[model samples]
Target: MPHFAATLRTGLCATVLATALLGLAGCVVISPFGGHDDQLRETTVQGDGDSKILWLPISGFISDAPSRQAFGLVQQQSTLATVTRALDKAEKDDDIGAVVLRINSPGGTVSAADEIHARIQRYHETTGVPVIASFGGVAASGGYYVAMAADTVIAQPTSITGSIGVIIPSVNAKGLLDKLGVEDASYVSAEHKDIMSPLREASPQERRIVQDVIDSLFARFVSVVKAGRPNLDSNHLAEITDGRIFAADDAKRLGLIDRIGHIDDVLALARDKAGVDEARVIRYYRGRSAPRSILAEAATGSGMNFSAAGVPIDLSVDSNAGASQPLYLWQPPGAP
Candidate 1:
């Protein structure tokens, strides 16, 4: 059955590839790294007569996940490593006059968001280039946190733009385990070592300790927001930072965003701030080299395409499995 399933998958991939080639003639199948070079060259041509406005996208979940190419698949959107490299390149490019951070995210882990925020701040400090954050459909929690580093933030009128707080989720399956007649024999050096273990209920002391950590992190989040938005009224600070999501209009009213505008508006703002009448706009793409094992896998003619648009089959082990970590993330009610 396993062999049959593998054969079926191979046949399906071959059919899909044939269909794509027939339907999309003249399409170039560039390697992931080659695509980045192609895009860079195209943008260089576009900027021949003007300064450049680099559009760096911050899409999907913002995490410090290692490069997806290490798993032999092109990552679709921003990861910390790729985003940092893009900013570094932009900072060194003399033709790049400004940066427009196109943010479309519901946020991710706390440390990852903080790292990206600091990188953006450093880019601005070193280059003196204007940074405009253009919020997309949703930019909540850590998404909004990173945007705070931008000199100006613009959100669409319908954009969901706030959810300022921290959350550390841990599942407790003690009841389920008991129902299944399963007993966990996990051992640790300290009582709090396995405090987040799903097989057992957290003790009151453990709960208190975790709550204290959350409180401290929440206070730090508030301080960062305050520093970024000094003009925000103190009266509305508590309400705005209470982990409630806000629409763009309410966000602007509460001083969470600078304006209600779209990507085009952000482009104009970037141009004006950079003192350039005309500027070429470009976005960065990941330039990851595929491993020899991946190349060998492709050589098998297994009818698989390890491209960005292709579904990834992660063969690498996840380091964060079963771990409880703090997040600056926002999930709408009913979200899984």
Candidate 2:
């Protein structure tokens, strides 16, 4: 009887927890305990009008794969998926006057950034809506790459932008393996199959092959930047494209960004370009209610997660957390 009673109590508590979670309507809830609704809810963040200024974010490590949480209980939308979803909705909404991309990232994989950039470019071309990029926190490398699709890029006074280049991180563990008396017995079908293998030091030919690939990617990056910023000086191109981060002030001076201002300034510029004086500034959220402020939500693209009960389930870990691939990322001296 006691065991049965305990079982009944456990079941009742779970039922109550589920009921409480379902009843939550005025707060953002990203929970592992609940299934995600595919539908995105639109909420007016600021102003009031028939027209809308969509606030789309490109934050964290940009990747095309669905974000895998640390707990692996739920899979969140990929950065590319989020962008695609938002743009898909924007395309259907005729009242969307403009799009403001709020970017805050150190960058991610090469393909993800390129795909996002292409999507944004296509969306802008098809809709003819003025797209503006608003840099927040640290928008470097792939973050800046994705922003190239924006008609005008604006950086906050304290924002860090730039770091243009490609990086394919590699390590040589031959010495370590020798000291540990371990051997790399893995064999390849072709000589160049394991070109940049970490098991051994790269040969001259392998290094050249890798360098060629990096050079090609770098060239593409330059072309994208040139297309976006026509006013970017040719002389400054060399210095700017050398893969280094810059403050907002220097970015503007180098013509990497148009202006240094706040989110209000970005919104105002977007409004002016869209020719809307009093449009509703809005953003899409998966949860029940929109966040109180534009910055209230956590980093959008980094795969951070929280529960419906207001407990943070996953603060780190992305789908592409650890992988050897070409990336347009900015990892400072000690950055993880």
Candidate 3:
């Protein structure tokens, strides 16, 4: 135990020294050994054939901004950036039979999701490659938005999707501030510069402006869904677009999803659609070790979060980092 403690101390000291040296030199370095170069290495998941199927995963918070990891020592590439890189790589490979997107997320910022959706749509149009979306646990709001780009969508039996809507989260801290005798006294140039300020109740005019913005975004969301799902019963359009979630069965029935199936089933459909009898399932990743199987994720550490006093430091940042950033998200109360 003593030897282990000494080793740990030495490692910490070395990290501190390196950090200091780099800071003094006005240079930022993620790792001394290697860094992310946006170069993706392919790891075959399963099967053996001349053609290949790319198993791309769209998981967690879909953000365009790069995520900080290893206590900001490493920058995990953004989901948008990764998608761009993956599609770029896939387009160059002629042997690529099809692209299967494994989506599992509650959703994120409107801009990020919309941008990814647009890119995928453009990719399919340009390459003529069949894009299939396979929903996992949850594919709500922005998650569903990106799936619009897919030629076909297959959801697991227990998958939860829909929640087709827009949201701009804001907090009202006026009551809390009153209890603490704190006041908001910031100066602004315009009459409604602080439109969604939490310090005070918004005027009717401000409320109207915010509602107008929401309505505009909602209209866009509906339009995107219409373009994606042509067979969707127009009669049920009002019911489906009421910001409610739907199960896999309901989604399929509502024409939001095409079929319900497992990963293997999705793969088979993909291979059949691409007219390939046999094909290797591949995953593109940026890391040192290769994934042992399709389900295995990269070994990239999220990052250490311990302070000198052994207290956990909150180093993570949410996609909604501002006061009133608009989103196409489906984050319910108590959701992570």
Candidate 4:
């Protein structure tokens, strides 16, 4: 009877936990861009019907767009896709006044980051409204790249910033596969055809080819930085080319960040620049309600069980991207 009761209790607890989690997942944030209590989304013309600040967050090694229905109640917050959608909604909203990009990311994929940055640029060119970037805890690499599009960037004194470089990872797991006794019998037409397979070693010449590609990409990164922060000394183009992070104050001193202040300060700047003292601060995250996988949820766990089976998405960080971090990146690996 005691054993049966224990089993029953365990089963009941599992059911309850699952039920609660599902309920939590159900509270999906339909649209982060949705104006507070309002039905429609579009900026108002004829001198500010009502000032609204759209908050967009770009965090972590961003992957694809988040889904709103993936979770039951609790949903994902600010993502790159959500930010883009928010800008779109805010653009047409007859009530919103300006946008405040709240950056709290260590950078993500280059193409995704570029897409966000380009959208911001488009918003700036098309709309006469002002856009400001407010840095949170840390925003480096692709994070800073996106923020550069903002008309004004505000950061706290110790905020981590910079990391302005580009790289594509090249992995050679031939030895590992050999040790595991995993033979890839798959056949390809060309001798160098197996380049896409991580099981094979990269040729010496291939290394040079990869390096050249990275160098070209790095040049592009510099070009974008120069164009965005034109006020900086553009003469010594290669001086700060190495990948590195910087403190908020140092970033400001280097002409990378505009001011040293918190998110509230940045919001004030957005309001002032948009020419409105009163406005609502809003956010947009489409399909962002999906619950994080158990493994991902426990990414911060000291003894959290992180099994490959429990993970939903495979987050990747290019090794080259880490090594080539421009001389201006702010990352706190073991920070509390």
lDDT of 1 by residue, 1-336 (tens): 999999988987786555446434534333322233212221331333468887777876778874232232232333577678788778778888888888888988889899999999999999999899899899999999999899999999999988999988788898999999999999899888887788999889988999999999899889989988887778998899999999998898889888998766887898899888888776554223211320111111112244466676543323333348998889776665
Query: Which pairs clash (backbone N, Cα, C closer than 3 Å) in model 1?
Result: none
lDDT of 4 by residue, 1-336 (tens): 999999988986675456446555554233222222312232221223356766655666543443222232223333555566667776786555677777878776666677788889998788867778888777888888888788888888778877777655445677888999987787879766665456777788766766776687677778878888877655544545567778887787778878998656776777787678766665443232321321112121111121366774433322224332222233445431
Candidate 1 Cα outliers beyond 4 Å, as residue runs: 1-48, 67-78, 287-323
lDDT tens digits by residue: candidate 2, 143-169: 999999999999999999999999998
TM-score of each predicted structure versus truth:
0.78, 0.87, 0.88, 0.68
- lDDT of model 2 at residue 196? 81
Per-prediction tally of clashes: 0, 0, 0, 46
- Of 1 and 4, which scores higher on lDDT? 1
Error of 3 at 16 (Å): 6.6
The residue-by-residue lDDT of candidate 3 on 1-336, one tens digit each, is: 999999998998798668646644646755654554554788898999889999989988888987764345556778799888899999999989899999998888889999999999988998999999999999999999999999999999999999999989887899999999999997999989988999988889998999999999999999999999998888899999999999988898889999999988999999998898999999888766667787776544323334658874545544345537788889788754
Error of 2 at 278 (Å): 0.6
Instruction: Note the residue pairs that clash in candidate 3.
Output: none
Please report how far candidate 1 places residue 316 from its true position, in Å. Answer: 13
How well does candidate 1 match the true structure in TM-score terms? 0.78
Specify the poorest-scoring 10-residue window by lDDT in model 1.
Answer: 294-303
